[model samples]
Target chain A: MSMRDRLRTMGLGAFGLLLVIVSWEVIGRNQLLGRTFPALSDVLATIVDPARRGLFQRALEATIGSALRGFVFGSIIGFAMAALGVIFPPLRAGLDRLAAVMHAVPLIALGPFLIVTLSREGTPTAIATLAVVFNVFVATSAGLRVGNPLHHDVLTVLGAGSWERFRRLELPGALPFIADGLKLAAPAAVIGAILGEWFGAPRGIGIVIVSSLQNYQIDLLWSAALLGAMLSLVAFGAFSVLERWVVGRFR
Target chain B: MLSPGAELSSESDKSADGSTDPSIEHDDISISTSPVLPHVDASEIGPANLSLSGVTKRFPLGRNDTVLALDDISLDIAPGEFVALLGPSGCGKSTVLRLLCGLEEPTGGDVRIRGCHPSELVADHRLGVAFQDHALLPWATVADNVALPFKVAGQPVDNDRVRSLLELVGIAEFAKARPKQLSGGMRQRVSIARALALRPEVLLLDEPFGALDAVTRRRMNLELQDIWSTDQITTVLVTHSVEEAVFLADRVVVMTGRPGRIQTIRTPGFERPRSPELLRSPEFHELVDELTIALDEEPA
Candidate 1:
């Protein structure tokens, strides 16, 4: 896309964000949703207050660590699952059903079980890993199947074996799709990490949310929620850039 | 089925002798003039280098429904000969090429190269094909795309061979460019170069220039002829263009659509090293007109 077009798209997005912020501030100040909803400025003040800086820092660090670890682990497992399906055609139907079944089970319901079996500290990363696996598996499997059939024919006539075909054609062709899966998996990882922490994990944004809700610390709760959202957004933005580069090269 | 080694080596020996003499003389011709193609008579050739006897293909379209794409088609291509399967759309000409390359199996009958199954050639890494779509890897540079056959064959890529092929196809300068960065003609050239990389015993082309403009297509045809002349590999070209079939092939096998069958076979009988002058000749126009008429009547 041209620079002007990119700028115009960014301008429109910024306008939309400004409108949302204005509406949020007006509603919160008016207490339209009652005392639970804090004004935007009050939430910002709570987040920036020097007294609570250490609390916010520790929470962000723990949550970010869990999400990052889960994202990497989940991505590797997901890709492996997809590759296995391609390598063994007979196992494809079974693997597909497995992924579907995994996705059907909700992360929220698994939180208590994970906390017990994996321990409080490990639960967040485990839940985050589960959250990412389904999306990556589905995206990668679909991606691996999407190359031009002509390319397949060319390889076949050239006497390529299954391994060579996968290595040379299917894998490279699936890069854009894999990147897309990773981009989508990023936000889910963060959400899963925060949710896992809510089930009595160590210091994290999720713990701050639950404690603030219990004690009626509305400003702190809002601040924590905003921070979690920013974490998800940052991961999403980074992967979006990577996705564009892959699509440019492989598609 | 023909045994692999003994027959192939003999066929190669015969072709090698025919091609060597013409190539030296061919180097004297300017780029604008066509290379002197070795004239090997279809009748004088020993045995079928590529044969399809009573070939039939039926594609299952849906449950209980099957489409008969080709019915009882048989053809024999001689060693070091160029044969063009010329027909209108859905004539199963491409199917013939597909059968020859082991990409598709015959529902009945046999498709063989040197008496062995086409798949045998494919397994031995001795069959090469170029499609209408080019199918060059979007991510790879032109040189790498051309080098792909060697890589696929589990052989070390001969960089010099790849470079010479780029030069042969007149795209040497575009070696660093990716498929998407080049024009349609250049991309097809790269595809052809890739197909030729391993020096396959048989070369199959399925409308390699089908997507280009008339001017570019004609130019590509001339270049293809020049390339083919040097090696004289047994080749089968699938195309609908009457002019193209007449200009390039030793024999033009015309076919009819709807249960595709060979309607007729015509030998243009043009001399080797046929030039641009041949394209405008009365004889060339007459043959093209006759084939065009035959193609027009294919539906009936």
Candidate 2:
């Protein structure tokens, strides 16, 4: 993009964000939604408040650790499933239905079952993995199918075996789609971790959210929610950059 | 045993110089031509005789509906022979090439390369093919693309062979460039280079230069001729261009559409390493004209 076009894009984004912040602050100050809603400034103050700094730090560390672990494990499992389907044509329809069913089952309903099976400490990562697997699986399966037909013909004429075809053509061709899937999966991992924490995890942003809601600590609740949003946004933004690089290299 | 267009043989006087050494005129070529333009030696490449006996192809159009693409086609390609399949659009000339490559199977009869099934040649890694699409991997550098056949065959990539093939196609400087980075002609050159990497016995070309403009296509034809001169692999090219068929092939198999079958097979008895000058000769135009008329004739 040209310098002016990039600047224009940033300017437009800033304007939209400013509009959102101003409307939020206005509604909170006027008590438009009653005492439950807090102004943006009050939420920021609570987030930076010295007394709550240690608590926020521990929660952030735990949630981030779980999300990262889930993202890695989910990506591996998802890629493996997609590769398996490609290798075994007979399994493709079954795998597709399985992925659809997995995605259809809500994470909230699975939270209690996960807690019982894996205990409170493992629930967060498990939920995050479930949340990420479907996106990665769908994207990877489609990606594997998106290879150029001509390239396949070339390999066939070259006498490439199934393994060689997968390694040289299908794998390289699927990188862009896989990167895009990962981009979406990143934020999903964060949301899953936060949701998992709600089912009585020891310490996380979700715990802060639940505790603040019950105790009527409106500012703390808003602060925790905002922090969760920021984590998700950062994950999305990082993968966006990586996705662009992969697309440029592979596509 | 008269030729089909024998009445148009007035250009016989012009063919006297058809046997002249083509390398003497290489300096006049616009592109950086190959230096080692050897005459095609029949004994150089092994027995790669391609034969299709009573081959028929039918593609399913819809439920209970089928389109006849080719019918009752039979031809035998001798070793070290260059044959061109010429026809109008949708005449199934490409289907014939595809059958020989084992890309598509005939609904009837048999297709063989060197006395074995077409698939057998593919399995043995003795088949080379270049399509109109070029089919170059967009992500790979030209050098890697050329080395792909070796890797596919579970053999170590011969880098020296790859480099020389690029030079043979006159694009050695673009070795590190990706397919998207080059123009249409350049990409086709890379595709041709990759096809020749393994030095396969049978070479199949389906309008490898069909996508290029006229000027570039002519230049590519000359380059292909230079390349063909060295290896003399049993080649079968499918094309719509009458001139290209005559210039490149020892035998031009003309076909008609709608249940495509051979209309005529004309042998342009021009000597090896034919130069650009041959393209302008009266004999070349005569053969092209005859084939074009044959191509235009409606199938009965």
Query: DockQ for the candidate 2 complex?
Result: 0.69
Residues A143-165 of candidate 1 have per-residue lDDT tens digits of: 99998999999999988888999
Candidate No. with top TM-score: 2
> What are the chain A TM-scores of the candidates, in order?
0.97, 0.97
Docking band of candidate 2: medium
| Model 2 chain B worst lDDT run, 10 consecutive residues | B7-16
- Fraction of true contacts retained by every candidate, in order, equals 0.87, 0.85
Across B1-300, the per-residue lDDT of candidate 1 in tens digits comes to 233233334444544565422234435443312333334332232212787888899999999999999988877666657889998888899988888888899999998787788877788787779999999999899999999988898999999999999999999999999898899999999999998887776889999999999999999999989888776667789998889999998778888988998777776767778788999999999999988887787455
The local lDDT score (0 to 100) that residue B134 gets in candidate 1 is 91
TM-score for each model: 0.90, 0.92
C-alpha lDDT (0 to 100) for residue B82 of candidate 2: 77
Worst 10 residues of 2 chain A by lDDT: A33-42
The reply for model 1, stretches above 4 Å from the true place, is: B1-48, B297-300
Give model 2's TM-score versus the native structure: 0.92
